[model samples]
Target: MATKHEILSEIDTNFPEYLTFLQTFIRAASPSPPGDTTEAASIVFDFLSSHGISAETIAPQPHMPNIVTDFDGGDRSGPRVVLNGHIDTYPVGNPDEWKHGGPYSGYNDGLQIHGRGGVDMKAGTAASTIAYILLKKRAQKLKGSVALTVASDEETGGKWGTRYLLEQGGKASPWRGDCVINGEPGGLQSIRFGEKGTLRLTFTIRTKGANGAYTQLSRGANIIAAQLIQRLLEIESMTPHLSEELRKHFDSSEVRLVANEIMGPGTAEILLAPTINIGTIRGGFKVNVIPEECVFEADVRLPIGLLAEEVMDHVYSILKDFPEASVSKQEAPSNPANYCSIDHPFAKHIADTTEHITGRRPVQLAGLGGTDCKFYRYLGIPAYVIGPSPRSMGASGEAVDIAEFKALIKIHTLAIWDYLGSNA
Candidate 1:
């Protein structure tokens, strides 16, 4: 097994180069709304190839591609660990909101690396690349294997990314593994053992249009859309029906403290609760004439103990009141909220390894947001998350601390070393 000091020293020597690698990756910019990762995927594929590493590109949809690198150790019987990270990030909604050369600018000031995807994930994906390189170099001495899956569709629920990899049998499930370690930003204060689920509903309301003066004949579709938005808020009041174990997990003082510190005040209490957001509301063609049609979308995220069906039930009950507004579409890509026990071997390995390197043992808690992790967890595989803090994750000024970025590489690399080299 490799010593912790040896790993740290090795990474430190080439740390500057690794930072540059991350900066280059961020500059490529993979945004998911338009969902084209060809430019970003090319960077990852080329970087690995330049290192004399072999990787394959799999794209169910030509626009969104996945880069997968797989290599086994001397003893293939040992547990296989999958390192997952998504290159695609939330679309930069408004370029003007970004101050430091816009979202794609991978700016570095010696302390932090700034970009839209850096905090959300590109930094971690870059770290995964470096770790994979280091692990592949020592494959002959190691036990099982390390597979790197840099996904492209996590921002919109992965129809063509991680989920597709799991579904592929042509490759004989090379991407499936004994455990998965994802680099979704969990703020490094906690090892996210689980995450909430999402249920997106698009409501469409239509009505016959009339001039503003003829309001008495028929109400505008916008009127009903506004009412539906208020009704969606009721889902927030739906309490979580969690098992005792999950309830106790969040109730722990240490877990609550970590959750609060990582996200914000009062986050712990709502870690397993529903959150409703009317993300998009488009209605009224013009200001003067009554609108003929209105379409609005609501994102209702369900906590671990709760099911999407229960939330849908509540939504249906509310929709019954407003027959004018109906669900035009629903995003069923969401999996049920899933988790691995905190004491699971892979989860413990990550926590212990991180504590060894960072001097602080990360608490175990369920994340408030979603990640590619749920795809693994839903398959009865243990998936753990550890990465840099999510500072301005989906908004402007997104960034990751340079030191934290370096720490992530070290921890992920050594943790796999510790696990694959272990008897357990």
Candidate 2:
């Protein structure tokens, strides 16, 4: 308790500078699709270097780069904990629609910090970065080590960032740890032990061209695309066979409130069942021309206990009727819904430490969307996400509450301290 108090005191005293760091971080826009994060990566690298923490940058994708740094505990035999975060943010659409001096503003209106990357998680990553720095500063004689991976390409699926480092060095990989901790935006009250998986696909239809009045000469591609969308919605009816115990846990008021509150209303419905979104559709160029081709993009989310292959099989079944229609997944690898038990030591450390800090226990629930955590969970490593509330992630006018962001830094630092310090 004494050590914890000392840590908290140091955090509070140093928080103002941390806020400045966060604002500077937010000001550096690293939106994906364009997927370039060179500037943000350089900023992270320079900051770490300024602190005397050496880092390595890997950029096989050129525009997208990653930053890695590691430090050992007092003893090498203690557990290795990986802290993961991303530099890229969702693309800011329509700069005019944003508030608080626009998306890149990094403006703090006293209560919240406004900007593009703060909610979806440049702020959370900041928490991890600072926690790593604070932990390193302690220079305490503890067991094991903590490694930080501030990577790029997470918003577009991490092909050149975290996944790259994880795949590089075999079993004793540079990024592999006993477990991973990710500061994704899921609100403080909700400690996410699992995440929903995604299958991003583009459905296409093709047919011989014809004049608008000459539909009899060829089938309209737009018609096939519409019918295909209708069939795909059937997949939404699918449900995961979760354990009764897990369902009972979710039934608890603590879990129910946190799940819906963190992810939004009706979260349980979507968290337990597969959900579908038909994002966009494009067909004929002009009214005078019969549509020869149509393309529609979709994002299908699977609940925990469901697999991507299961959904793909269902998709293939639905496409049997239309030979002209075909579907293809996005180039990045798709993952299944994954998790570790709520009782896992790392998860409990976060939940318990948060309760100790705030006097309110956090509830375990699954987040609605995917995160870099899934990549580690796929390899049998447990990954947990507990960060700030996602007030307007991937949308205009994104913000992070000042109080909540502060709480995140404290909780993460102490939980990490609790995990490794105990080993000493």
Candidate 3:
């Protein structure tokens, strides 16, 4: 095992250039705008090329592109590993919430990188890129390969990114690997095992016409809207038996109480069931005449192994209580949860490497949200999330701990070395 001093030295040697590259990336406003990723993807690919890595940009569509590069581990016939991350981020919301300049300003706050994608992900992407570069430089003759796949449109559904790559045969790409590691915001301490599935449904409710031409007091859609809101709120409040993993993380009574209070009675139970969110509601066409239509769009996050049909059944059950309600339309694009046992050989290696580098053992973590890891897992590849934050502080405050960053580079480097027996 490399000593902490050795790891620190390595990071110190590479840190300057790495920070420069990362800052440049942070400056590029790569928000996912439906099928558009030209500038951001190009910048990432160009950076990789400048670092002496043989990189390729595969633009599936004009707006979204995929940057791929790899190092052939000696013979090029051994196990292949893919390091993946998205190059896009959600739009900078409420710039006033920003402490520095604009969200894409890439302001170096003396201690941490500050920007929109700076924490939520751009940090992970940069860490992964730098680690890969170091790995290629240090472990030159392994028996396998290492691929860096930085894709676009992840802020949205990844339809033009991962999905397009897979559809156009990502597995067929150069340096395509057997398993993948998605560099999501995992706080650099825990290896995220899996994520919950998602279901989006829209409910439209209509009321009977009023018998008035100019003004009708009681014949408007408001009545039906009121009932629908009440019932929908009820459905949103349904709680299921949360997975053991979720309970383990949120164990305090105060947290549980807050969950219940906001989610309503049985919210915990329904957490294990399917989670629901009424995101949008709009009704009432005219003030004088009662409008006859009311609609609501809901977002539901489901735990692993739960079927979308089962979720819809629960929604129907809630609506059935109100006879006048109609469901209208629904769609659930689900990516089943994927987990790797902490005791698995690779996982053990990663954990051991992390501990060796950080003097801290890794805790197993479950994904509260979803990521493109779903796509890789769906394709029969075991994937996990890991990154550079020291705690659960992505999109919030707290900078990426420099120590954690150094430790991750060492851990990932050794893990890859162990996989390829490169040290030999």
Prediction 2 global C-alpha lDDT:
0.86
What lDDT tens digits, residue by residue, belong to model 2 across residues 1-424? 6767878998899899889888888998899879888988887888888889999888888898888898888777888999899999999879999887888899999998999989888888999998888888765555789999998988877878888889888687968899888889988887888988888899899999889899788769998888888999999998787899887886787777777777678876676888989999989999888899999999898888788888999999988998999999985746678877888888888989899878888888888888898888888888899888875788788888888888989988888888886532
lDDT for 39 (candidate 3): 70
The candidates, ranked best first by lDDT, are 2, 1, 3
Poorly placed runs, candidate 1 (over 4 Å): 97-100, 207-209, 213-216, 422-424
* Candidate 1: Cα lDDT at 170: 37
lDDT of 3 by residue, 1-424 (tens): 4533454577778777777777778778776654356776777777777778888777767677788778776667777877788888766547676666766676666677667676557777777777677667754567778888888877777777776666674568553467666667666556766666777776776666564463444545657666666665554444445558556654555444533543346544443445667777787766656667777777777765566676678778878766556775443354444554444556666777777777766665656567877777777666777776524233533345545555556666666667766644
Candidate 3 similarity to native, TM-score: 0.82
Q: Give the lowest summed-lDDT range of ten residues in model 1.
A: 328-337
- Tell me, by TM-score, which candidate is best: 2
The TM-score between candidate 1 and the true structure equals 0.93
What does candidate 1's lDDT look like per residue over 1-424, in tens digits? 3455666788999998888888888889788888899999999998899889999999999989999988999898899999999989888888888766888888887798888899889888888888999888778767998999999899888879998998788336888898988878987778998888878788899888999789887688998788778778888888988778778878989888888888989998788788878877788867889998998887777888888888888878988888777884475555677788778887888888899879999998888788998888888888999999975788778888998999899888888988888332
Stretches of candidate 2 above 4 Å error?
214-219, 422-424
Candidate 2 shows a clash count of: 1
**TM-scores for all candidates?**
0.93, 0.94, 0.82
State the lDDT at 297 in candidate 1: 82
Q: Give Cα distance to truth, residue 99, candidate 3, Å.
A: 3.2
Flag clash pairs in model 1. Answer: 187-389
